[model samples]
Structures are given as C-alpha cells and as structure tokens.
Target: MITLINNPVQLKRELLKVVQKELKDEELKVAKSDWHSRRKPIGCGLTIHPGIGCPMQCSYCYIYDMGFSVHATPYSLSGLQLVAALLFNKYFYPTRWGTYLAFGSVTEPFLPNILPKTLEYLKAIVEYLGNPCQVSTKMVINDENVDKLARVGGSKLSILVTVTSLSQYVYLERRAPHPLKRLELVSKLRRKGFKPFIFIRPLLPGLRAEEVDEIVEQAKASGAYGIVVGNLRLSPNIVKRLISEGIDVTKYLRVDLGKLKSGFVDVRVDGDTQTLIRERALSKGLIFLRRACCANTVSQLLSGYNDVACPSLCFLNEKVCEKSCPSQCKVKAGGEPKQFNFHEVIREVLGFDEYEVEVEGHTMYIKLKKPLRDEKSASFALSYLFRRRIRFIYE
Candidate 1:
C-alpha cells in the first residue's frame, strides 16, 4: 500500500532508506549503475528501459548511435531491484502524482524476449511506486499480453501504439508489425477499458504528412482516445540508413548531412502539417497532444488517480496544451497551488538548511547561501512535487 506524506522531503528520504535497507548488495550495485537512477530532462521524466537493444531495426532509429545493439536483451535488474534503484534516485518521487515513468525509450519494451521483464517492471512500479507509467510499442500485442498488461497497469498505464507510416512501413519499419495490425491492437486495448493513443512519432519528412487524415481517421475508428505527434530527430547514422532505404533525405536537410558527425539534428515539420494534424484530431473529437507528458497527465486524470494538473506545468503553454483536452488542468492551475513545506523540501533535497524560500503566484524563488551540488536534480524533484517553477538565487 502507498502512504501519502505531506512533506515531500521526508517522504523521499524515508522511502529511500526503507528501500535501501530491504535491498541486497547485488541489487544495490545494479541499482547504482543503472542510468534510470539519474534525473531526466524537464519535459521527459525518467526513462525506464526494460531491456537493451531492439531487434526491430527501424530505418530512422537513433539507438545505434547510443551504443545499443541490434539484438535485444532483457534488462539485468529484477523488478524489486529496479524499484530500489528508482527510490535511490535523487530525482525520483513515488506515487500517482509523482515522477513520470516512461518505458520504450531505448528499446522495444513489448518484444517477445523482453516482454516478461517489461511486465515484471510494470507490476512492481504499479505495486510499489504508483507512479504514472507509460509504454510505447510498434509490436502487435496479443489478447493474452493485453490481459496481462491490463491486470498489472490497468488505467494507470498509458499505451502509445507507434504508427509512423502506413504506406512506407515496409521500407521504414520492415521488421515491425504492420500499421493496420497495430491499429487492431489499439481497438482491443480500448475494448479492455484502456485509453490507447496513436503515436505518430518521428513524423518522417515527405511520408507522415501525406497520410495525416487517414492516420487520424483510422486511429479514431480503432477507438484511440487521442493522437500524439512528435517531430523527427535525425542523427548522422539515421540519415544514412534512411537514404539507403530509398527514402528521400533532401528536403529535411538544412545543412550538409556530411557535416553532422555526432549528436542529433532536429527536423521541424512545417506548421501547415502540424495544423492539419491538430485540426483533424480535433474534428474527430480526439485529444491532440504535442508532448508525451501531456498524454501521461491526461491518462492519470482519466484513470481517476488524482485531479492534479500536469507536473511539467504544460498548462502554462497554450501551444502544447490543447483546448480540446479533457483534463481540467487550466482550471486547476487557476486555483491556489498545493501547499508544501518548501523550507523542509529545500533542506532535504539540497542537504543544507541555509536557504530562504519565497513564493509568488505559482513560482518559488529559493535564495541560496551557497551553490548546490546537484541543482538540476534538486530543482526537478522540488518543482515536480510542488508543481511550481523553482528559481535559485545565489546570494
């Protein structure tokens, strides 16, 4: 069972100590070395990888640049150990309103070899942490797998079925399941009381925009609650692979492709294309989301977890927060922010008691006597828990 503590600082420390005491040395070692034990970026929460590598070598995948193998392997940590690692993480907060846990970032979480580990991790997260969990997949999930997932995550787990290109699936995602079959999985998920969303991620240039209407219409027909559109990011290797697959790479390139050696280059889709998707989605009465966190937040609200607004505070940005969104975040934000012991939270997170906190509207300004050791992680946890923008002033 999960307990709610009014003081987030104490809650985090107590949870960490309890989890650490229960873990074995081997578990602790695995927990310590895992990358999930670090603070993720502002919009993206901690990415939980159920496995390493992906057998479905999509042409646009960038995992190869990150040193992941083409062959898949389940993550080494067991469910309990994975939970312990998350608790040990300085940035992680546990509960329905806590840190967002996203899977299928680096590898396909629902693959046959890795599905067991994925389910184990999901069960443990739902049982112990109760954080908002989400999984994205291109694989066609069977009835048995769907039932298992429903039993474990239920409404708390947001499902994102990736369908990048219908006509070009053979060239782009050759090994993955067909787009139509994946849509069928969406229908099944909806029938089982899950609000699945069609994930049109990496909106491939010259490919995805053409089929926007058909994709949105099919998604709505398949009983998807909404559509999430993501922009494409191209790494050098990804560009090479796409070119080799007989896909055009000229229009997406602003600079010479050869000049880019390391890191990813963002390819912004045309505004008209984005407008088209948003309009189509809204016409179908389907919620259109630009960020994954928005979908996660909506799923939690619809699941009856809590009425709390988005932890990322996306409601402040109109572009990302859809007017058609059923979440009452904007209205909730208009009300008074949740009260927290800011002084204590600061002391617990920063490991010092020499800071002064000032609150104005929805933002908290912390005047620090000295510099923090890990400002990013501390700010992320505090801001997420309190749903306030944290600004540290060095005096």
Candidate 2:
C-alpha cells in the first residue's frame, strides 16, 4: 500500500512527479505553457477554462474586449493534461483546503459543446487535487446534465447560476437562455444536493426595486441557499455596446468614457440598491456573499468537508463577511493557532533556509535572508497554507 502524504507541499510535489511520469514529453511541454499554469490575482483563484470564446454575446461581457473570438471552441488540453498543468503551477495547492479552483471565468463552462469538457475537468480535479471548486454560468442545464454534475462533484462544487434581469434578459443577454430558465437550473441544482446561489452579476443599471424583491423571493422559493451580488465592470467597447442597446450608461459612469481605454471600469451601484438586495436576501434567510470564494468556502463546509475558514482570507475584513453567512468565517478565522514552526514551513515550501518570522493576529511577517524572484507567488501560496496575510521583507 502506498503511504499517504499529509504535508500539502510535499504531497503536491509527489503528485506532480507521478503525473509527469505518466504524461508524454510533448504533453508535459504543452502543460507547462498552458495559461492555467500561472498565478492569478489575489482572490480570483485559478480559473480553469473548459472552453474559449463565447457565442452568447452578452452585451456587458468583457471577454470580447480581451480578444476571444465570438465563436466558441473547447479548450485544447484534455482533462489529465489540464491537471498536470495545474500541478506544475508554482502557486497551486493540492487539497480541498488548499487553493480555490474556479471555472468559467473566460467562457461559459456549460455551453453545449463545452459541457463535456467541463465535466471531464471537474472529475479530474476532484480525483487528483481534491480542491474546492466553483463554477458560475448563465447557461441552462437539463436534468441529465445535472445528474452527471452531481455524480462528479456533488456538494463539493459550488454552483452559481447567473440571473441578471428578468425583463431585460432578452435585450441584455441576446443569445443566452431566459432568466427564468436559468433560475430553474438553480432550483434543479439545489434539489440535487448542491449549494446553488443566484448570481446577480454586473447588477445592471435602472433595475426597479420590485424586480429585485421578486428575484429574492423567487430564488428563496426555488430553494437557493444564497445570493451573490456583483458590480458592473465596463470597458469602452462594452459601454458602446450597452449604449447601442438603448441602456443609459451615463448614470452608471464614474468617469469619462474616454478614461475606460483597455481595462474594465467598475461602475458603482448606489448604496440603496446594494442595501436593498442585502436586506431582502437576509429577510428571506438566505446566505449573502459579496465574493465567489466566500460561497466556495461555505459550500465546502456545508458539504461536510473539514472546517476550513475562507482561503481568500476575506474574514480579515468585517465588511466583506456578511452576517448572514452560515460559516461564521470571521469567528473561525480568529481561532486558528497563532503559533507554529515557521522555519520548517518556509524551508519546505519556499526553499528558504534562513528567515525571521512574526505573527500578529491573522498576519504573518517574514523577513527573508534574500529576495525571491517571485515574491508575489511565494506570499500567495504561504498565505493559503498558513491561512494568514503574508508580508515579506528582505535584507
């Protein structure tokens, strides 16, 4: 019998070695060059793309601005190859309590042609990595596909079904499924023992108060566990598209349209709109999450996984931890042991031999003997491993 490795970094390296031995030289080379093998921004986690480009052509989507074709195509890497690439990633962690794996950032994971690949990738991740996973989609899934998803991920996967507007979906989402249909998908996911959340992303402008209330009521009635509200992010091309669709962009803009050149500009929704949604969600006894990773953490805990606080460390900020969240991550975050052998962890994980360490609350200060070539990735991995904010200093 093979001995199980308990140390996360050692286990991750061992798993990579095993996977590398199984992969062809060309496959390993391709895996190393895959986009998923890089470190993502803080809190975004690692986005696994089952497919590239999107045919749905939602007016507010930023994928087009990033140069993905309007035509959809499944990602080239196979499931095993994808896993190999993730294992090779210097920043990726291996277990459920390790790094968060997110799906459908660049493309809709459940698009008909892409769904098979999505399922394959999910199975591979669950079997090999055991990381907490989340997928956000506006696509409608049928009962059969739901069964397949449940078999592969069950409650371990956090599902976010996007429902932006009931009335404006036709104009806003053009080729995507109706908002009502997507809500049905959420209901189905919930029925199958999945923690599904109604994702109100890019909270479009000019939505009436009653519509928000109705959405909250409908979501609760459909058995959704929670709701996630996201602000609109607009690029110049996105602004032009929305303007052509007859939606007023002026009220949502905080800066001149010319200022939004390449990157996305976050449009601030009024405080009342945000408060109203939060109030309605809380009144209905539904969990409210500001970020997707928070939902991932809650889903893992609710699924009977070991009690792990939010890996994104959102609990450090009280404003981000909604009181309605069942995990009570804020309280759990404070309970982590403040003392541990930092020397062993740094030496094993970062290959650092000499370092001075200080721990204050949820923050860990490390003074390294020398600067690392990639301090950002090192700090990110250490933060996830230690469940603390990692601040690095070099002499």
Candidate 3:
C-alpha cells in the first residue's frame, strides 16, 4: 500500500483508510451464482462481468465484493477463462442461454483500458457460443467502438444505459457520463439500428420521483425501445451515507439489514408503485415493462401473472411497473434456491446434446448446465424447437 496523501502522516493514514475501505468494503460478493440469476428483468439477461473493478468508482455501487478495489484498473473483457473462473459452477456447468450475456455490472465495459483482444474474447462468446447478447455500460463510448459493435451486433446486439439519477448534483454517478450523454447514446443506438433501452435503476432516495417520469418520457422520445425501472438497494453504510447527505433519502432507504444477511438486498419493488408506473406507461403509450436482474422485458412477459412486484424503485408510480413486476427471488420454502437453469439458452444456441426441443409450453423453460461444445447445436436446435425460421444473430 503506497502511502497516498498530502504529508501530515495522520492525514495520509486517513486517506489510506478511505482507499482501503472503498476497495475492500466488505467485498460485494459478486460470486458467479450471485451474479447469474434466472428471473431478472432484461429479457433473460446474463449479468456477467466482462472485467473486474471500475474506472468510474461510484461510491454507492453494489459490486464491492468483486474484490478488485486496488487494481491499477479493471480487466476489459472477463477473459473467457475468467468467466470459467467465477466461483459459481454455472459459469462452467454450461447449459445454454449463453445467448443473453450482460456486461458492466461489476465493471464498465467501454473503459478505454480494455484492448481489442479482450473485446474479441467478449465477441467470441456470442459468436462461437452461439447466442445473441447485449452489454450494459456507463463509460463514454466512442464512435469508432460504436461502429465496430454496431457492425458486430447487427440486430442481435443491445446497448443498455444504466442511469440511476439524472441530477448532476446527486453525484451518485460522479465519474459516469451524464444522463444526457447516455440519452444521446440511445439515439446513436437507434441510428445504428441497434436495440437500445434505458435501465433507470438504483433510484436514489433523496431525488424526486418526478425524475423517474422525466427519464421515462425522454427515453421513449429518444428512440429507446422501452424503459425498465429499478430501485436502489443500499448497505447500512450506504444508507447512512445517503441519509447523512442532507437529503430526505430516508424515504427510499427502507432496506432491512435482515435481508442482506440472507445474501441479497431486501429492497423490493411493490404494489402501489407498480400501478403508478403502469398508469404512466399507459398514458405515454409505450412498450413499458419491468425486470428484476436479468429477464428485463422478456421475463416481464414470461411472468404471465401480473400481480407480482419488485420492492425497490417503487419511489414513484405505485401501480405500474408493479403491475407487471415479477416475483422477487426467493429460496423455495421446502428446497434449495432454484438454480438458474440454462436449458433454454443452451438448447437455443447449441444442439450437440440432441433431442426434440419444444416450444409454447415446455420449449422455452429450461434447466441450465449442459455440455460445453453443444453451443452451436443448441442454436440450430432452437430453430427447430421454436419451429420458427428466424436466424439467430450473435456479436
């Protein structure tokens, strides 16, 4: 630990404490299973870390446990081997939905530090793994990279902008590009004909709920395909810092420490809020949907029963996103937490483990973890399984 600071020895030590705390702060335990989930919001999304650590270094980020606080910088692409390195077996168990890989949760994907070879590794996952995928980012992406990704993504690539708060003063996102810039990216995405969506997540407590509506409207107008709302889940220290910031963030800081003890944040998106968001969607006349972790629009659609809801981001719209929100993740009362099955993803992108894949009822539902090499065969199988001749595109 190189001593970092201005000299009064005491101040120097204090500064080191700050750095150590920020980097090692209880490790936001982003284990493989922890990152991977079955019933999330972004259409069967995969919250994979392309790399570890972040350049932006936002204080409120939930990924401290990635254990990369002190690296000179994070890895750009979580090298395919690194993916296999995630403690969670699912990373290697290999069923299939390798289709919907997500980037930027644990770190920013577009950071300038990541070299081409790294990006190639990320691209190879989709191309050779045989599944369509998208990445979420907050970095200021350049036109050249966008062009490359656009060319690569074609119709299958998606760029999701994670904008939590729009107010510049909120500084919740100090190093990240401004919300306006993110909105601009949406335009770029549309121009490139790539699917674009806005993830207005981690709704800060002090910020007015109106910010939600403003963002929703802007995203829809800016050529966004849709909007998904999520709430902020804070740790005790995070909540303390938020409230101490001299704002009424307490309204949304209702996280119970008990839930965190159980391994995930208790913050949830619920009823009245869901209804409120839904009404807003109806008024706006847009394709409005909500997601948990990975499912996004697709899971919202899959969660046929509309009564479930997520508790966070319920700061505004009591009933809307709630109306469509799916059930929060939970351990089945009688058994183990349901493992995120990769059957659908696998069968869709590969077919080596040949079998009659189905559609409608049982076809889409899957149990993850199949043979690794069967990736391409799974992609081929989905065509027959779905009985739809749509070509599966990958980046």
Candidate 4:
C-alpha cells in the first residue's frame, strides 16, 4: 500500500511511528559520543584522535587536566574504518561541502610509539577520502616522514608545529622534542612543498617584545607559511599545577585571582599585546591568524575553501564553534530563511543521489526513487530540511 502525506501536519503525525519502528529491531546500547563532533571548534568538520592522551604533557594542556590521559595511548580507527565512519557521518557531505578532517585533537598524531601507524592512517585517509586534513603536533618530525606527511596532506593539509619558546622548551614541554628540532622539521616540511605553519601557543606570557620578534623571525627563516599566536588558557586544576611547579603565569594575563577556585578562566593576552605580535608577524611577511583559525585558514583560502564552519579556536578551549549568524556559510545547513532549497537539503541529509519534488495545490511532495535506509532517517531528513522539528510520510 502506498500512503501519501498531504501536509506538514500529516508528516508530523508519522514521526514517532517511524522512530519507534526504526529502533524496534536494534539492540540499543549507551551511545558512545563520536569524536567526529569535536571538529567544529577549530573550523574543521572532523577530528581524528590517533590516541587518547598525549605523552608530551605540555603544562597548559587541557586534555591532561581533564583526566583523559596524560600519556599517549592508541584510540583510533584503522584508516579504512575511519574513511567509512566519515563517509557515513550525517554531518559530512563531501559532494557539495568543503570539510576539513583534523588529526590530533585529544592526542598527538605523531607521538613516538604511534608514529608509524599514524602515518599509515594518514595515507589511508588521503587515498580513500581525500578530504582536507590538518595535523597539529609538538613532537619531533623525522626527516623520513616529511614526504609522506606532505603526500597525505595533498593540496589541503596544514601542518602546525607548536614552538612557544626555545629557551623554555625544557621546562614547559618536558617530554616533547627540543624547540629547535621541531623548528627544523617545519623548515624541512616547507622545503618539501608542504604548508608548514608555526604555533607559538600560550605565547609564553612574559616574553619581551624582542623575544617575540626573534621567534617570528626564526619561523619565517624556517620557511613557515604563517604564524599563529595564542594565549594561555587555564583551568582550576591547571592553575594549581602551575602554582605547585613554581610558575606564576598570572602576571602575564588579565585574570582575577578571586575567580581562581570557581572555574576555568581565560588568561587572555591583552589586545595591545596581541596587536604587537600581529604587527610583527605582518612586518615579517607572515600571515597573522587570529582566534582559532590557527593558520588553517591560510591553506583553506589558498585552496579556495572559505567555508570555515566555526572561525575561531574554540576547539582548543574545549568548546565547539557556535556557528552564530551563518549568513553566507554554505557548509552549515539552513541558511537565509527566504533562500530555502528543499531539494538540496534532501540530497545532503538523506544521501539521495536522485529525487523529485513535486508541487500539487498548496502542498509539496517529495518522491524518493530509492528507498531510504529506514523510516527514522526520513524524519531526520525532514527535520533538517525545515530547520526545525518536523517529520516525514514514510511508505
């Protein structure tokens, strides 16, 4: 029997029927939160964690403070599995959207023990998905892995190497590679035709103007394509750790000590200080990236992918890009209310290659040439298309 849905109310009526039927045959388990959703903060659509924790243990690292893991441990999918998960993820629409997949959000991708497998996973991602990817790391990049990394990044990979202060690397980074070694790796990657950017994160709050100038100059000399500067972000646990270690980062940031026990605080680098760094970067002929764009925008722009989902470094702060005011943003669904394209929405959300939308009298009808995966998916598609809670007519 073929049932036709006449109006939006009819669609809404069948919503829960489809949902209950969809779940009837499946054994429900507590859903594991997908790591794919972690990409919004840094403007990428997908984030792959090669491991659960980082051995580097940089003092300001939020992952450590959050108790995920202080040492690196493998927690990633095989390359092919990662490709499948990405392709099937509802948020990904490779045909019409430019999405970036970032490696190393919760863990370091190229940590010593996991480097070989990480490289293999990178190769697989490039070979299979070919999506734009980025890798942010503090580990030493060996001479051997440079070409492979470049190949994996394809035209869209941006490798951001973190080097805050060479003089303080020993104390700050602890187990990570020496600052010079990491800088040398950046130079090599640049020489090999890969886009390498410098991340002077947490910008080591009390450095002199000359010290900042020296770091930027060195990065430029190393063939860095751009420079990303960030200020120290602190959590209550992290603040305690710093204090216990006899490091006082408070004077370098605009912080209210009274708020210390309350919750996490952003010990922001002041506007004047940030501007000074930005000016220095521009003066040295490097692009000064602000917020969480984190030098990824440079590559994205050069490659003509301007649809950054969330244009700030919200990821680093354990937050997602809110995507507020998504006016001209194509990657985000549901744009200007007047410019609604229902067919496009159906194609994107339902994974339909072919469909026809017909109008009869006052009602719009969608005909699916092929059956959807399930009734629930039809309702899901409807909700996304209307940019609100709606259902679908399932036959």
Candidate 5:
C-alpha cells in the first residue's frame, strides 16, 4: 500500500530501521503513521485521544468510523499520552523538534462534559510536554480552559474552530454550535492573546459560494489568525444517512461513494469555486491554507502566503523556529524543489540538532537528534529542504 510516487532512490520507503539508530522512539512513532501522506521533515505528529466521541456530530466527520468515543471520556485515554511521547522523543530525538501535536483528530477536545477534563489534559501537555500542538473543534468554549492551554504550552499551541456555514439552515453539523457563536469564541481567543485559526472545512460541494465567502469574512472579522479550508468527502454511510434525512448534497459533493468497502472514491471540487474562495481571502490579506495533503492540492499551497512575520510569535512557548525556508513559501504540499545537506543545511542555518544524514539524488532527509522549530525561518527551512524532493514526493 505504500506507493513510492516515483521516488528515485526510495530512501523513505526503506525500513524505519534504516534510520533506527539515528532516530528516537518518538521519531519512530511518527514514522509509524503514514503522516496521512506528508513527506515533510517536521518533528513528530502526536494525536492524544483522551476525550472520546464528539457531541457536535458533523455528518461528514470521519471520526466515529475510527472507533473513537462519541462521548467524552478523559479518564479513558492514557494520561501519559502527552508526556510519554514528548520525553521519549526528546530523549531519543533531541536535536529535531516536532511542530505539532494535533488534538480532536479522533474526537473534539472541548465537548461540554469533556471540557473540564479537557482543560486538565491541556494542562498536562503545556506543562509537561514541549512540542507545539493544535486542535480544532466546533463546541462552544468559554475562557477558563483556553487560558490553561496558553499558559502551559504558550502560543506553540493552537485551537481550530470548525464552522461550516453561518446559516441557521445550513446545519452541515447538526449537533455543533451555531456559526455565530463560533465567531464569538474566535474573537475571545485572539483577545486573550492566543492565535486562533478557522477550519471552514468540508466545504460541501453543495456549499454555495456565498456561504463560503461569509465563512471566510466572519473568520476574518472574528480575528482568526488563519483559515484552513477543507472539502467534504462522502463516506458511504454518511451519504446514505444524509439522503434519508432529505439533505440534498449532490451538487456540493462529487464523490461516488454510495457503497462501503468500494475503496475511496475520488471527490473533485469545482476549480472555479475554489478559485473564488481563495481570491477573496487573498484580497482581504488573510492567511488561507488547505487542510490536507491531496485534498488541498498543489496550487492552493502555492498561493496566499502573507505570513512574512515570524509566525512563531503566534506560537506561545515552544520556540518557533523559522520554517527553514531560505525564502517565503506557500499552501503547496511539499516545498521549493531543490536538494540540501540533511545535516549541514539546518545545522548551518538554524544552528541546532547534531545528527547523521542520508542523501539520495536531489532529496536529503535528516535524522535529527532532536526536533526543530521555534522560528518560522527554521520551520520553513525544513519545508524548503523537503521541496527539493517534492517533484517526486507527490505524483
């Protein structure tokens, strides 16, 4: 199942042991997940699923299918999920820094009953772990827990609010809060000095252009630092459910997934519609990005990069390493197409991580002693480093 996408040397496809002695347990853990298909050299990606099940059930959510809780269960998760991953990774992967610890990938982090424990969990990560983490949810939030996250992890943390339509009738998500309420929370998050981002995702193929614009405008007005838009993919069961519920989604979605286990049906977004959305955000000077690898496309990544400012400031405590890019870059999947000395490029430019390197053709993948990031330059530099190999990373 691991397609090489035309890798010339296929070093990445080699066994993890190829870099085993060079990587730590944490790095190895990161290597375990397919990264959903990203070939970046970022540190690690941790998803701590302490809170199971989200009440704000979006019909399009891919969670329940994963068997995470449909209800909040703080005690259900390994309390040490955060600390264990960090300490172990840091112990072994000392030089490389992982950029994110995404939450709510399995369940919402701020469900009402889960909020109190969720706060405690946030406390655990920020206070105990060092990696900057992120989460996106649709639940209505008050300030108490937000403060805990900020205090513990600093701006190295992020809370993404998932709001599909500002329209009452839209109800793209039946159980979640109204779009207006989400707007209020976005503002509150920024006022408290935290960087808030919006995931106006699963932009259903039926989502009207006006609806898309309204979401973007509202996110901007609510003081969101950026917007990560995602499109809706039809899962067989969800599609059937929506049809039975009388929801007309055909025009808004393009995936032919009426039957389960038929494999993943490709979903196509109307190019013109996508263009309209991106253009509006660019005109308004907002940072717009797609939410996934193949879903976001290469051009979306190529456009709208106004964050010349050191985005790490938005990162609270974790040192925001510059993105390691020698220059400004984009919404693209990989980075600038070029090669680097895996060990030397970042070592010379950012001055961190003492590790061994392996170079294959135009690409140079690093095995860092520690994870890197604190400044945008460092982070971008990593992507820039990977861009050299991107031409073959994605086919």
Candidate 6:
C-alpha cells in the first residue's frame, strides 16, 4: 500500500481503471421513490436528478451523504433512460394539477458537464410528460442554455435561486458563482418572464435581524417573485466541514450534540428569528414563504389565493380547491407532525411501503415513497377512508 501511494502515476492509473469499471457496471434507471416530504420550500413530487453527484461541493449540502461525495464513483441517468423511467412510472399525474416535477434535489442540475444532458432531459419531459417543472441552481447562467431552458420550461417553469449569504458565499459555496452574480442571473430570468424565487437556505442560525432584512430587500430589488428562507439541516460531516473552515457552528445555530440522529448533528435556528425574517419580508412587500416549496410559491404568484391573511397569505399558501386558498388558516406544529390511521388507508390503497404523514389541524401532508398509480384513485381512497373533509397535500 505504501509503495502504491509513493508511485503517484501508477496510483492514478489504478484509480481510473476502478472508476471506469464502476461506471460501466451501473445500470440505466431512474429514482423509484421520487416523492418526499423534504425541508425545502419546493414540492418534492417527481424529483429528477439528471446526474448523480454534484461537483460544486457545497460544504453543507446533504448530497455528500446521499451518495455523491465519493469521487471515485459517478452516477447519473442518460436522457433516454430518464425519459424512459419517467414514461414508465404509473403514478405520475396526467395533468398539471396532479403532477409538479422538481429538479436538482440531490444533484446540481446544471453542472458544466451535465448541463447539456439536463436540458435534453427537460425537453424530453416537455414532449412526453408536459408536467410543470421547478429548478434551483448555483451555477453561472449563460445565454445559450438559458434560452434552451426557456424553451423547455415554457410557461410552467418555476425557478429557485439559492443565495444563502452574500458574506459567506466564498466559504460555503466555494465552487458556485458569486451570490451577487446569482442575483443578477435571477434578474435576467425575471426579464425573460420566468417566475424566479429566491431561496435563503440553511439560514445561517444567528443571522441578525438587519442581515435578514438586507437579503430580502436585495432579492426583491433583483426582481425575485418570492423568497423562501430555510434553516440549516446539519449532519456530522457537515458540522465537521464547517468547523474545518473556521465557522463557529454554535454561533450560527444551536446544535444538540447529544441528540445526533441518522448521521446528522441536529442544529436549528430559533423560531423567533424565522418569524422576524417573515415579518421583514412582508413589510417589504415581498412574497414570504414558510415550509412551502417553489411550486406552492409559483401557484400563489400565478393564481391568487383567497381566505389567506395579508402577510401570511403570500407565504404558506397552497393551490388547492381549484387553485384557491383554504377557507381558514390553521397553524401547524413543528418537527414532523403525527400520522393518523387514515394514512394506513392511503397506504393500503396506494400500495406504498414507506411513507410519512404530517397532520396540522385539519390539513394533512402525506409523503409517499412512490407516487400513486392514479391521483383520482388516491383521492377516492382518502375520501372513502376519512368521512371528514381533510385538506391534504400529496407529495
């Protein structure tokens, strides 16, 4: 082993040989369970990862643990394979109401090498599925691909531009474009008539009230249609990375070192700060969102909602009841709401083995590993299972 390490050229050759072999061994396939109850303010239904790992290497990104950090092994689906997988899925919705496709969840959809393929994949979705799609990226946008994206996305394309921090961009997003440049790109997309939303994700825990306001104002000034703020979801590896970069993880957020679960070090910002952020956005006339995804924001932007409060209406608004808001607003409890027995009925009818159900008052957020074979069938099953009229968001 020592000799192999000493001979750098030989080591490189051997590693290349193994990597090529693994790539060849990989099979053409798509994700089986595309639906998820993710933490982002984007819908987690029918997520597509055109490529397997992200080269950007954001220190805090969860994809590091989701099978993308291993430099030796690369994974991705080909255009033909992606189209085939999507077409073969029986659970996909035929119309826009039931089907909202999201891209770039696990991998950067516009990585330099994979950008062309990503465009191809989007075009295929347009031709075959015709489902509304959403994408968030930190890559530098160019005229060539931007035009292609417009063609593929058409009127149903929702864009999320993630800018965690203008100050911390150098440290956190080492490989991605500058935060200000990303804002410029957002403005450009807005000029193109795309509904681009700003995502201040992993909202560095201890951000000052003024700092939050600044981000909101800047995004709004940049022509962002809406803004979504998210807290950092930290894992042990992520914490270690931050620490190595001299980031005071504790100062940014609270970390329960003893309560680590699923390889993640639990860290979260206080609710008061999040509330303050929302208030600031509302005061600035910007569309603020809480725990909602890009799809929800786009729905609110395109089709106005009723029965929603002035400040909170623009945020946390869902396009249910024929793209209308709910009759009344109800507060939801945090930290994964409990699932009731009605979920069992959904499971039995939809044939889902793995699922999560979050019930907030009368509203139920159900996340299925695999999409339902038929949206109407699932709705019918829910209607049959529960006599009460429960608002449900199927992810």
TM-score of each: 0.91, 0.93, 0.59, 0.68, 0.63, 0.66
- lDDT (Cα) of model 3: 0.47
- Evaluated against the true structure, the overall lDDT of model 4 is 0.58
- Superposing every Cα of model 6 onto the true structure, what RMSD results? 13.9
Q: What tens-digit string does per-residue lDDT give for candidate 5 at 62-106?
A: 666666556666543333343433333321111113234556656
Q: 1-395 in candidate 6: lDDT tens per residue?
A: 11242222233234334433343333322332232212212234467666667767887788877666533222355544454444334444322322456677677777777677778777766654445567778876787777888887764477788888777778888888888888898888877778787887777765677777778888889998767665577877787887787676766565776555566552446477777876777777776654334334344346343211211122233422112223233332222222234444455556666777665544456666666667664653343223122334545
Name the top TM-score candidate: 2
Candidate 1, residues 1-395, lDDT tens digits: the string is 34645565576566667777788887898898887776464564688989999988899888888899999999998888888878777778887667888898889999999999999999988877778888989988799999999999886688999998888889999999999999999999998988899998887666555588899889999999999888677877887788898876776546466656757776756477778889889988899988788788888877875666778888778777777777857676542345455566667788888888787767788899999988888888777877778899999
* Backbone clash numbers for all candidates listed: 0, 0, 63, 2, 56, 6
RMSD of each: 2.4, 2.3, 15.6, 9.9, 11.2, 13.9
lDDT of 2 by residue, 1-395 (tens): 01233466777878888888889999999999998887563574688899999999999999999899888899999888998999888888787657888898789999999999999999988888888889999999899999999998877699988988887888889899888888888889988999999988888777789999999998998888989877688888888888888887776546576778757787757467778889999989998888788888888888885466787787777667677788876666553333244455567766867788777777778888887878877887788877788888877
Could you say which candidate leads in lDDT?
A: 2
Model 4 error, position 141 (Å): 2.0
In terms of TM-score, which candidate is stronger, 3 or 4?
Answer: 4
Q: Rank the candidates by lDDT, best first.
A: 2, 1, 4, 6, 5, 3
Q: What value does the lDDT take at residue 316 in candidate 6?
A: 38
Clashing pairs in 4: 292-312, 292-313
Question: lDDT of candidate 5?
Answer: 0.50
Better of 3 and 5 by lDDT: 5
Q: Write the per-residue lDDT of candidate 4 for residues 326-380, one digit (tens) a residue.
A: 2222233223322245565566555765766544422345566667776565554
Off by over 4 Å in 5: 1-44, 75-81, 85-96, 168-170, 245-247, 251-254, 262-270, 292-362, 365-395
> Mind giving the per-residue lDDT tens digits that candidate 3 earns over 40-84?
323324455555677565656666643565332544323343333
